[model samples]
Target: MLTIKRVETVVSMHQQLEQVPGCGRDCLGNCCIPGAKLPLYTFGIKQTLGSNKRAHTSSDDHCVPGDVGDFNDYEADDSPQENYFLDELLLAQWEDRMVRGLFRYDVTACETKMLPGEYGFIAQLNEGRHLQKRPTEFRVDQVLQPFDPKKFNFTKVGQEEILFQFGPSEDNVSEFYEKAPVLSSPNVVAINVSPIEYGHVLLVPRVLDRLPQRIDQDSFLLALYMAAEANNPYFRLGYNSLGAFATINHLHFQAYYLAAPFPIERAPTTRVSYGRKKGGVKVYELSKFPVRGLVFEMCNSLEDLSVAVANACVYLQNNNIPYNVLITDRGSRVFVLPQCFAERQARGEVDQEILDTQVNPAVWEISGHIVLKQRKDYDLATEEYAWKLLAEVSLSAERFEEVKAECLKAAFEGPPSDSMAQPPALPNGGSYNLLEKEQAVLIKSNIHKANSMDGVVPNVGEVGVEG
Candidate 1:
């Protein structure tokens, strides 16, 4: 693996404020004005609210929009609102970090386009009684440490507009993104977005067309490889289907990069437990933090890896886990990792019945991780779920043929929307249309999924929810 140099990037708060592409800023100004409680990516990352006056203005020391940490207390904001008693905790963190020279201000990307009925969507956080148990720690999730932008040792990097500027244009990059929606074959373009704690980046197709539900192999993997290569690479990548946590109606992929090593679960665990299983070797442990142990027995080939994953999940399920599984080949052996389900239960915020009750295989459309709703910096369980979910729906030889058949069926079943694009390449070895694919993957950011899956759900028994 190539080593990525950890270089210090000096992004100034004032520069970020004035340098924001006038055209890129959404009409609602949700980017800087505060829309949710979570701080996606902060310029002055090392700083927080009420930290140092040198990093930021004393009066404007708090978050630009509003100090939104825990989302349950999310209130509608037209402009900056004077809040402290409720926001003090979160704001202080940002300010505190600012006092120290840890993190700083940097420009960010997010889904800013608001549809006809999109304004009040952030107001729909079901803090009330939901199926899944909400974590006690999550109670304060509505409030979190804010991002300070002053600490960034600003040294003009000079003329770097093209780096952040993405997406296809009808006029500007017409040559780069030529294929039109109607003119191109269906299922040719695909888009997916995710939002995690801190580490965040937007990955999308270059085309200006709709996003695809299922992509072919080469194109899918290429998309990941390409986006992973972006400057502000995400620590953890995420994808939300049309109505599944997808805040934006546009086609794109939102990645959570700040909170790398995934610090969501309480005492999040990353130890590779070793042991044995039926199919082959086993590496199973508690999913959501404070791990129990791991079991790695044996491994002969890729098939063994696949079987081991299945076996591990079966064991956890028999233990009444209803857990999440992440399977990957590690040194010629398949590694099966299990994240137990207790954090959600402890929080009294998880919906156990939603998976079985509201699951709609047909309309459920993009399967895998469909059950994912809320995400946090400490919830290792949520992190594991995303990893496993990606494996379940990713493009591969085993399921691409089956997925392709289903994508075709969905296409013929209904009229395509501008938001919908062409067939996506599977996860394995296919290629992406350099131009159109780019535009099709365009998206804002984590504000990506305020509440797109309010009533939608995924099939609990089965992971893949195809046509």
Candidate 2:
């Protein structure tokens, strides 16, 4: 649980951190988002605090930190496709909860309590305070069109629209790309924003490595609550677990302007409550994480909003999911996504797994959906069959649990997959002689600060993550 002491420590740490100089050449301004479980998890590993502290930095880096018990889960190369390719590729899905990351984290209790002259680092965020109030309806004339996979063309936009690349430096690319026509775009604000999602919205921070997707928890929650109270239509906002959705890889949210009640919420689907979970939600108790909550449908005041935001935090603790949650009286929904994530979405189009079982590079992510990447093990002929097989396993509680159990076995650098038919051998056809290659060109082991740009773009015939 966060106390005055912990909050105070964090504030001091943040202040000290701000004093440091920027490292543009090697860093990206990736701000820590609110409620960063990974960093905290890393902290715990360093301190050897958790029951298991055995974690591996990479395949070779063993746990000197007493080996955080489950390192591979958060490791860089931890790909869901590599493990449960068939199940996920097979279209096996079930209803799950959603939580917006930083976008929703904009809300905080302190922010809601912000007075006219209550100036501070957080006070600066009150630029749009007046916008927040009793929820208002957004009436639009645009007809709604159901999302069709066919019409959904996920493609990249280059110089036409600025790309939010999380790179070391890209003066050449920036020189070629012109600012897009969007108002208040990040590229307009700064060139080095995050490349987390395909359709990234916010501008990358100028101070590389300073800002993280994880943010000030209280302030962010307050921001969301206030935003919800603004002249908008959405009733509730939500998020999903890491690695659960395609977007689970890089942290981001799908934002939409809430629309009027659909047919589902009306007659046959009168189950969902616009304001609250029906039956008072059983006070929604859980023992795993800490919680804070307040229901705001009763009062429309900021105080009520703050209290509600504070209370809603309990839901985070209760559910053990990092989130930015808020409830407005509106009976509509709202959607927000990365401003330039179109490029990211473009990669999702390759819906079918490749011969090697890589993910469809196009249309990678969207509300509650994940496009499993098909890679090496998934042969094209068997890719479809592979997807079907895995889908069945995921849908079945028993099989899903089994996969989960098996996944928990190997740490990032621990022994390879238990089910491995054979050891992951080096590429045949003399890919390279490791010893000779290293001798010819000096090589060192480092997870980060390595060939980031090289890794991001396609390498001579090598299909790149970004292309």
Of the candidates shown, which would achieve the greatest TM-score relative to the real structure? 1
TM-score of 1: 0.27
lDDT values, one for every candidate: 0.25, 0.21
For residues 1-467, could you state the per-residue lDDT of candidate 1 as single tens digits? 11112223322112233444332321112232222122211111111111111111112111112222322222223232221211222223322332332222211211111111211011111111123221122121111112122221111111121112222222321111111212121121111111112222334442223333222222233333322222111122333332222333233344432211111211122323233233443332223322222322233333343334333333332223222221111112111222222333345544544332222211011212222233321122233433332333223343333432332222223222332323445455434443444334432221242233232222212111111
What is the TM-score of each predicted model, taking all chains together? 0.27, 0.24
CA lDDT for candidate 2: 0.21
Please report the candidate that would top lDDT against the real structure: 1
Residue range with the least summed lDDT across 10 consecutive positions in model 1: 118-127
Summarize candidate 2's per-residue lDDT along 138-247 as a digit string, tens digits.
11111111222222111111111122221111111111111111211111111111122211232222111122122222323323432232222222233322212222
Error of 2 at 321 (Å): 4.9
User: After best superposition, candidate 1 residue 437: deviation in angstroms?
Assistant: 14
